[model samples]
Target: MSATVSPIREPLIEGGKSYHDITVDLVRSTEKAPTRLWWIAFLISVHVLLFGVFCILWTIWHGIGTWDLNRTIGWGWDITNFVWWIGIGHAGTLISAILLLFRQKWRTGVNRAAEAMTIFAVMCAGLFPVIHMGRVWMAFFIFPYPNTRGSLWPNFNSPLLWDVFAISTYLTVSLLFWYSGLVPDFATIRDRATGLRKRIYNFLSFGWTGSAKHWQRFEALSLVLAGLATPLVLSVHTIVSFDFATSVIPGWHTTIFPPYFVAGAVFSGFAMVLTLMLITRKVLKLEQYITIGHIESMNKIILVTGTIVGVAYLTELFISWYSGYIYEQFAFFNRALGPYYWSYFGMMFCNVVSPQLFWSRKIRRSLWWTFLMSIFINIGMWFERFVIIATTLARDYLPSSWSYYVPTWVEIGIFIGTLGLFFTLYLLFTRVAPVVAVAEVKAILKSAGDQYLAPNTEHHEEIMKQYKDAEDKGKVYGSDHAHSESH
Candidate 1:
């Protein structure tokens, strides 16, 4: 194609050519075959899932009695699992909604997988409360709906009831937020699909045509949802913390629980994001899309949140001592040097001290180190919950009632099973859902400009042409030395 050599209105490149004459090819390239590693991950996750089923069957036959639950410590691994999974869901909204509001470009790389993590984590979380209910069928009694035989109503003031509301709201809103972004990408698949795939994509696309008007409305709706979700994410965890803080137990009754829990939620959530992104970027061959910048940004958040959580831990101990409450003081002492002291220290070392290493750029950028760190962070976060719930409840008021709680085989089974369930769903989502937001990526690649665009790039030439014409007219006719400034 013929090209202009000079235009006073456009900024000149090193060669003194105006507008840089950038060109971009719009046609996307696809991989020839699914990566071998993805198949390996899928198979491994399935094997773990089968082990989970065996555990569930054993639990069903053995009954709740198989798990240790004394009067003083009614909640144990089940509650910890619930909180851990819910906390894991937190980062998805933060990455998607909070970062989106800030217009952070790096989010495009991680948001899809993070949102998928939120949905799967929530699914894993929902199981604990249901399975813990024993009958499981009567789990709906937590709902506020009226019963025919009795004038029964769930206590709105209770945090558990609030959980029903908060969890439901978070899951509903996150699903909508995720699907809203997926629509245009789904349309891309719809256009590319054949046979039965076409019908499935067609229904999911909702007649999307990728018109500018559709994008305009879609962007507006996304922003609105993000606004709604930002507070919703914070509130969900705050309410969850209240489930502990509102209690009369000495360790659980602290005022700092809300913010502490929020920090931990975000900390664990970001860890989960890191875990998934590290694997996905390689599995999907998306290293160019999900650059090192994105991982570093996530690591920074993890580091900050880790420090906050560490501070919360120290502050709680300080307040417990300063308050001069014997029970509160004992709770802190027990957590640090009690029977489960190893667990407490493990949580501290993993959640608090370890993330400090992420401050080093080399640690953040190293794939093997990042992967190990993410796993440690998750383990640390899980132990944080376990220590909080188990340690606190295991040694409450009245020495007569104080008894150490232990998780039986069934309890262990269910806990392990949840991990299986989480990865199983995540593995399936990788295959079925768009692993990355293709449409959003295209928009980003377009805006980021010629740095990523390559030769035979005909589609963007029209854009360059219009841009040049607009720039040319805006300049005043002048000598070769003349330059036009952008308003």
Candidate 2:
């Protein structure tokens, strides 16, 4: 007797949907009126957003003194939040651009929402530096435009200046990439719609037709943008890291900052993506399109990036000890055993220990555990930022200037407000746009379609013969006709 082997199964999509079915299922979300849950979520987000706006206005009127910053701790919650949000935006590019270039079919399900999240998160991140300037009206001084200040220009060598160029370019390229992907789907909506929707979608579709030539162009354009965005994503966080690494501060001055920050960014970004997608999948009834397999794949990425970030943390400690620099060693020591030791430990637990749960296949596949882990990762990443910014600044070499920094209600409100802003935009996006890429989902349907399992070669041949006889007998097959006829 010969041993039998079962074929490995992999489904990037579920429900055995056709291309037309995918278009209808995804586009219906945009066409339908807001559900009760959507309304409730939107209203709550709006209220929170309004509160954030009020806080911003109040801060503007009260000036920078409303927050808890002193001479010792010049940077606090504002910069921390800025870096945190920016880091969260990295997963979008990684999923859409990097994964696309690498030919990862799994990206088709989640890339649309991930890219949108990137835009919203970056917008939220951009607010902090502007608001932290105190005189928000004079924020244009960061630009290099000629002014009446007699050839005085923004410092060309500053990483802060580099951030302006980097973020703007990133946002622009991401927007174009996202919108370009949406064009064909928008045309699909326009064709299926009537009256007011027809007119609106027509405009949004930018006169796209399903011509072969057009698709060829679209594919080329997408590939080019993905190529451009790959480096931009790496550079953006690298420059952000420069904001710290280039500094004279002991904790901030390390050559490892670039790669460390990039890994942390991807780690945090994936966490946020999972957090939102899990909620969206449940509420929007999109489990078939964004299946359990998709969740598992994303969890694997979180585990990998989380491990990388953990390694970076240990490397930082090792380097601090090996450098033979007193300030650097003390900075690392203080982070682990200082007034903010709780936060440092929190970072270690959330970022390093919690993700280790995913090593088990059962835990990786469990929705609840995955969601909880994602939230924990975000919490750990936030504390990591706080530990870096506060612990180092609070305990400088000069004891006379040493003071613990704490965020005031104003700073707290601003951070919460940014959350409100991000959610508001995301919720609105869910309503107005197809949360998943309809076209890409349709393309992958063949791979994820129903499969027949046979225990052995004989069984598989027997099953195929039966199907062949049925086809020869003029039985109508519902699957791809060419495939059935060929057999």
Candidate 3:
């Protein structure tokens, strides 16, 4: 069969064949070590997950009184964790939904895992609010359904209600968005399956045939979903901030909370992305696919968002002082110098000062340094939430109401248990799903960059010389041309 050349430039393999035409057996090709690493992760996460289950059961059997919450120090690790996990969720949506709208190609390497991270982190976050209600079973009271006992509705005016709406919306939208991206990938696996796996993959694939027509619609739908998710991302964090903004509490009530919280969320989210991508890129041996350039791009975002967060901190302090509200002033002061001052200082050092190092190319490119920075950013973000919730609640308006809150064993166990939940979901996702988008990879592999195509230049030069010799022999045409010119 004669080869038909494509009008568009096609990616050439070492032998000048199209890379897109090469079929990969992912099961055979994927590294054994990565699989082993995932198995180890699975085993560890399961143990921790079981431990979390025990903590939940113990908390349920005992009661809310088993924990350290009081009237004064009502919110503690629960709220802190909720905010932290939710913030982690933001990075995925930002990378996939927001960056996609901007047509950023580098996002392809990170978006899949980030989206998975978003879903899992949100799951971890949703657990806190439910469990923190003391009577875990009675947590449904936050719902807006009509009650038989009285005509009571959840307070629409409350930030807690806003959080309920925001988080539920965010989770629902994120799941849909993530699932939509998975459909084509699931089809790829389905085609490679057999027996029981075939049936399961068929169910998941929903009859995807990789038709060009279907792909066109799929692309359009993905764009629409990305657009929807982008706003939802911003709104979710803004509403989370409103949980603090609407409160009459001094440090918590600030106009700057929305942008500040969003910035902080993106900052923490990118850090988590870096943490996961660094490991995955190395473990999966996807160096050519992910590339150092992708890591550098994320590092730039981390630096930008981290600086924005830093500015927000300074702004919060400035506003707190400028408002002439003594309570606000005191709240800011207490954050820096109060009993929990060390946590606040830790937050500043980790979030504000630590990420500045990423501004340098050397630090951003080093995997070890990026890993350390990611961990530091996570710790700092958690501390930030703690400072916001714990410090604010610890010292309210009245001295009589002032009290210290310490996490009981149950509280700490539940907190540690949720980490298990996050990891469990993440590990499973990496194993079962295409951790990277197969179609997008195929598409990237199809695009030939701006390099001139060269094929056997030595042979071509010889052919050109032969053509020149043949042309020189056509001097009869030159003689005819001279005769016509003389006439």
Which candidate wins on TM-score? Answer: 2
Give the residue spans of candidate 1 off by over 4 A.
1-36, 449-487
User: What C-alpha lDDT, on a 0 to 100 scale, does residue 300 get in candidate 2?
Assistant: 95
lDDT for model 2, on a 0 to 1 scale? 0.89
Point out the higher-scoring one by lDDT: 1 or 2.
2
Query: Could you tally the backbone clashes for each prediction?
Result: 0, 0, 0
Task: Estimate the TM-score of every prediction.
Answer: 0.85, 0.91, 0.86
Please report the candidate that would top lDDT against the real structure: 2
Please write out the lDDT profile of model 1 over residues 170-269, one tens digit for every residue. 9999999999898777777677778887789889888899898888999999999999999999999999999989988899998999999999999999
| Candidate 2 TM-score over all chains jointly | 0.91
Q: For every candidate structure, what is the RMSD over all alpha carbons to the true structure, in angstroms?
A: 8.8, 8.4, 9.7
lDDT of every predicted structure (CA atoms): 0.80, 0.89, 0.81
TM-score of decoy 1: 0.85
Query: Could you tell me which residue pairs clash in candidate 1?
Result: none
User: Which should have the higher TM-score, number 2 or number 3?
Assistant: 2
| Model 2 residue 29 CA deviation in Å | 1.2
Worst 10 residues of 3 by lDDT: 446-455
